[model samples]
Structures are given as C-alpha cells and as structure tokens.
Target: MTSSSIAEQVSTFNEGFTAQIGPELSAVFDAEQQALTAAGRPDDAVGVGDQLVDATLLTPEGAEVSLATVVGEGPAVLVFYRGAWCPYCNLTLKTYQEQLLPTLRDRGVGLVAISPQTPEGSELATSNGSLDFPVLSDPGNVLSRALGIVTEPTAEARAAHTQLGFDVADSNADSTGDIPFPTVLVVDGDGRVVFADVHVDYTTRTEVDEVVAALDLLP
Candidate 1:
C-alpha cells in the first residue's frame, strides 16, 4: 500500500526492533545475519532451469495437496518463509498480498507461500495477511530440503530466541528449527524454474517489482 520497497519497510522494522531489544540482543541477530552471509547460498540449491520435485504440502485446514496441483498449468511464484511467528515473514507476506498478488493475478500467474510451520501457523499467516492465495505448510521442510534451501537458526541465535520467549521449533510441524532460506522462485507451466532469488538474510526479501520483471521476461 505504501509503494515503498520491502527493503525500506524491513529497515524501519529493524530500527524499531533494535530500539526495543537494545544492543545486546540486537548484536546476537547481527552476528547471525553476518554468519549466514559468510556461508553463502548452498551450492546445491535449486535454480533456474531446474525442474521442481512435487511433494505433498498441507493446507491451512490440515488437508494434503500436491505441489503440481498448486501450480495449475501456469507460471507461479513460490515464496518460502520461516514461519508466522517471524515478524519479517508476516511483513513480507502481507506486502506480497497487497502489492504482488494483483499483478500476478492479472498476468494469470499463481502465487503460493510455503513455510515449515504447522497448519495452525499457516492459518495465522493467511488470516493476518488476509491473503487470497494459498498459504501452505511444508511440515518437515520436505520440498524445501529437496530444493537444498533448508537451514536452521544457529545455537547462539536459538538461545537469543529462547531469551525472547520464542523458539523456532515450537511453530514448526516437524518440531525442529529447520526452515527454508527466504527464497522466491518463478516456475513455468511445466514446473521448471525460470527464475530464482534466495536471500540468506531473513531481513531482506524478493521484491514484487523484480518478480514481475522476471515474469515479463519469461518465454
């Protein structure tokens, strides 16, 4: 709604969070982001021209659905996020709902969001964002792991999360901290990825404009 980039919105959130959490906890998160940056994207991570593997994903109601069915013979934008408990995830998803979904709809592209969270978490994300597109549960990161995009919070970061009375495992259906690095992929009707953007830093996200431009370039 604001037309500002997700990066700008996230910057504002980070400033406010730093003000609330103070320097100590903020440093812990900063260290985590730096570590992720140093580690870099996984060598085996899925990319453009790769064919995505189909997997059973859960709906918000706990029913099962196939990834192929979700794609529905059209180009789709797949968003991978940590969970509903993450403020950054919530903000990104809401922004996609407001900004990305309309353009995607007009282009006849499907939009789907996947997370390792349980059905309840998926429901919360959908309701919070008032999203019309499917918000799916990846359970144990089945599809994400297959894509080589899975990662978990470091022990130090996990401790910081605990200090804040939050644990990543608590929201996950697998009862583990495993989550997909914030990633977005544009796949063709045949399920081959045409474009992929992965963010090792959770504070950043794939922008709607970039995604639209990618879609525009598709053959």
Candidate 2:
C-alpha cells in the first residue's frame, strides 16, 4: 500500500479501537459504581494509626503544606483524587465545598483535597469557585503510591482517553500516569485514619451527610 493509504488505515484502526474500548470502559465504570453502592458505607474507621504518612503538597496559594501536619491539628477530612480534570473528582470536591465543609468546620474538623495535579491545575480548579478547604497537589503520586492506591491505566483505556480528548498527562503531570481511585479518609486528632472508603468506580462517592455523621462519632 502507498504511504498515504497506510497512514489512513492506521488512523482508521486507532479510531475503531478507541470506539470499541470506550463502551467497555463505560460498562466497567458503571458496574463498579453499582457494586460500591450496594456494599453501602463501612461501619468501621480506616486503619492509619500513629504512623501517618508525611508528604508535602502544593496548596491553592502555591505554598507547600504537610499532610501529617494538617491532620495533627484536629480531626481532618482528606479527599484523594485522580486529578482536577476528572468530573467525579470535581463533583466530589464541589459537594464537599457546598455540603460538608461547613458542618466539619463547626465541629473543628479541617478539610483538605489531595490530588496529583500540578499547582497550576489545582489552583485553576479551586479558583473556579468557592473551595474553602485547601487543594493539595501530590506530584509523582508519591504519597498515593506509598499508600498503595496508585494504578496505571490499561493501553486501551489510554487510547480511549486520547480519542476522547482527555489529557491525562496534563491532568497528572507529576505522576506521569498512575492514577488513584477516589478515596476519602477521616483522620482524628490522634493521627489515625478514623474512616476510609476507596472506590474502584469513579462515578460514586461517599455522601456528605455520611461524613458528617462519622465526624460526630469521633471524640
């Protein structure tokens, strides 16, 4: 085949492959969401103990903040993310901003959102609206990888992401590619992960009310 024809065939194949993978990924996400919903909330808290992981993350103001220090003050609500580019993460953050932050603050609990996004992207996402809490940037997914929550996307998923114009690289420049499943942890004053929920699905999240109730249980 001619060079032009060969190039055209390759492009066509990529497109077809992307199309095929998109629906499959969507189904996987849907199934995972359903399973998480059916499982309901965990009755117990997360096991972080006194050995809280210490990592520096860039805040929205471009300042470095330590995760352990933040949690050491009092009870803290830490929300982990794949990146600011994710719709589910955005929704989850917004929900917390709207619904959970006030309640948590009333009870003397600090709120923080952690992601692998660069400082610029993290600031942009938070600046778009009112996020009273700090958005921390975890470059290289160093903390997430240490927490055993980092996962690489499959080749097909990457192809589908490219076809869909989703810039995972820009979303998580520091991490290179590893993404974290959306997870939330409630840490008490003693530096323990009091409550934790990590979901395989990106669509579902812990309800804001549920988090408040969990905070209420903490001393």
Candidate 3:
C-alpha cells in the first residue's frame, strides 16, 4: 500500500506545521479560510459535459498560449492553483508533477498548471518545483473570472498574507490577488469537460488516482 494518501499527508502537515508556527499565525490562516468559505462560492461555473471556455494565458517566458491550442490536442488536464506563494499550492503542484505527469505523457494527455500570479512568479514556481508541464499565468484572472471561480481575499486575509511575507499585490501583475478554487478540469479534444473538480478549501486537491480513473473513462 502507498505510504500515505494525499489527504493524510496534507492533514499531517496542517497539524504539525500549524503547531510549529504558533497559534497566532495558525489562527490567522484559519480565519482566512473561513472568510473565503463564507464568501459565496461560484456555483454557475463550468461543469461536466460543459465545454471549457477558451482564454489566453501568459507563459512563464511571457508569451501567450491559448486554451484553444491546448484543448485541441488530445486529452488535456488543467490544474488551477492559488499561487506559488501558498504552501498548499506548492505541495499539490509538486505532487502532481511527481505522480501525474508521467502517466499523462505516456497517455498522450496534455497537462498544464495555471495561477493568477505574474509570469515571473509562475516561472519561479515551475523552476522551484521542477515542474515539466507548462505553467501559465492567468493575469487578471481572465479565465478564472469567466469560469466563475475567481475570488478576492478578505482584508483580514490580506493582512495575514502581509504578515506571512506574501505580498500578493506586488507579486501578481494584476495586483488584485484574485485566485481560483484549486480546480482541476479534464477536457477531451473537442473541448468538452469530462471531469471537473473544484475544492472550495484550498488545503485539498484532486488526487492522482482520481485523475487516472477519470482518464480511463475517456474515449
């Protein structure tokens, strides 16, 4: 059996790290999550059988790459993250890179990660995580906004971020600090969404086995 499931791993980190960081910082983070959850989540977003909308995203190298081009190629999996600054996002992306990318390549499925950070920030994340897939910058959340997953941080959350040294305003080109719901969408060649999972809680993510099972059902 696998040593630990992703949920187990994240739970362990959440418990141990929070303890190590002291209650003050931990409470701030918890409050932030609560605020986000309290803010009504987007319900009219994309769904299974719905076509994934097309948008242009900035590559790490500062070039434009369209969802049109990405979805046209065989099966594609789009992983939308909060930002490289978030530890949970880092862990999730690294996990996907280590566990999901190989099978995706073998199966001829395209994999891409998107975040609302600046292009430079996206490049930093790709390099730091050693991610082989394209890391796209969704500036101003053009795609996220269209998909109805865009969310702005609360004032308390922003203050907590400042305390944590994550100046999202400075790092993101859009300067809004708007982020997605840690979403994953699997699209077929025709741009139809075969699988769509959006985690309102940023601490969680869609697991590797889930992706494998979803891909197995693809035509």
Candidate 4:
C-alpha cells in the first residue's frame, strides 16, 4: 500500500523509453492508444463471478498444464503478458516474483504467467524474473483470443519494435504478430473470476498489493 501502483511504476519507466526512442517511434504508442478505444477493457471482461475457460497451456519444459487443475486446487492468479521481449512485461513479472509470489504461495493461491511466446522465450522470462511459479506458453494465443483480450500489432508498432532490436516473431511461438493485453485475473476454486485487471495500455499492469487484496477477499 505504501508503494505506487504497477501502472504508475511502469509509467515512470516508459517515460525513459519514450525519451530514448524519439517521436516517430513514440508515435506507434499513439496509434496503440487509439486502437485501445475499440479493444475490450476489464469492465467488459469476464469479471467478478464469471467463470473462466479451462484452457490448456504449455509449460516452459514443454508439458501441457491445465488451468482447470490449477484452479481446482484453490485460488489461481493468471497473468497474461506480451512476452520476454517486452520490457514492461518483464518489469511486471519481476515485481510479482519479488513482491507477490510469496504472499500468494502462503495463501495457497497458484500463480501462473501465460504468454504467446515460444518455450525458449518462456525460459528467458522465468530466468529473468527468477520465477518460482509456472511460466506457460499460449502457443497461438488461443485462450487470450477466446477471452477477447487479443490484439494484433499495427505495422508502425512492429517497425518501432524492430527498430528497438526486438523481433516479435523470434519470441512468439506462432509468429502471428498477435498478443494479449497485459492482464491479471484471479479465479477462485470454482474457476470464477474474482478480480480482473485487463489493461489496454501495454505499459500498465496489475499491482501486486492489489492482487493480494483481491486474493484476501476470495471465499
């Protein structure tokens, strides 16, 4: 509660990015902001009380893991990220690992991060975050698309990313140029969404303390 929201923290980081990348590359963010106008926000999402789909994902070790099984045990925290190439995603995940994971584990809440990246990229993310929880691959972003959180990058965004030395195709398993919005959904034992934080802006994320507060409210 003493610290800033994850969005606020990342906004500070993004200022650095915007300054480093200059106006033309920064304009891609402008385009993305416009696109978010048509995109699904968390208020319209499968929110508090709506059940989640029991989707399957591939672990970094290439094993198939079921969301159903995870949530069946108790509460689950699902984090959808853009992938290892994204600095914002790494920052969010790392913060969760340091500030959120231990609390969730103590409460018997399962924490998993899902991304449309290859197993290799998942490995990079896990190592980067020093994550103790599962980092799953979404393959073609099938689950995220089903949840109405999927979006394809604009050409300008792609070019800007490439200019920054990040190749989405190299990280994503499908190479489809599509990704999920940064989202965090807390599902209870019955697989219903109790807390949903889906951000239209890629620079933002669900704060760790907020997620813990949500988990505390879980019945």
Clash number for each model: 0, 0, 0, 0
Q: What is the lDDT of candidate 4?
A: 0.83
> How would you encode candidate 1's per-residue C-alpha lDDT over 7-121 as one tens digit per residue?
9999999989999988999999999999999999999999989998999999999999999998889989999999999999999999999999999999899999999999999
TM-score of each: 0.98, 0.76, 0.92, 0.90
lDDT of 2 by residue, 89-126 (tens): 66567767876777887888998888888887788668
Ranking by lDDT: 1, 4, 3, 2
Model 3 per-residue lDDT tens digits across residues 1-219 = 234556877998898888887798788778877766676456787788987788998988899889777556698999998888877887778888888888898999999899889999899889878888889999998898878787767777788778767777777778877788889988888888899888777887899889988997678
The most accurate candidate by lDDT is 1
The number of the candidate with the highest TM-score is 1
Worst 10 residues of 1 by lDDT: 210-219
Rank the models by TM-score, top first: 1, 3, 4, 2
Which pairs of residues clash in candidate 4, taking residues 3 or more apart in a chain or in different chains? none
What's the CA error at residue 41 for candidate 2, in Å? Answer: 14
After superposition, the stretches of candidate 4 with alpha carbons farther than 4 Å from their true spots are 1-5, 37-44
**TM-score for candidate 2:** 0.76
Better model by TM-score: candidate 2 vs candidate 4: 4
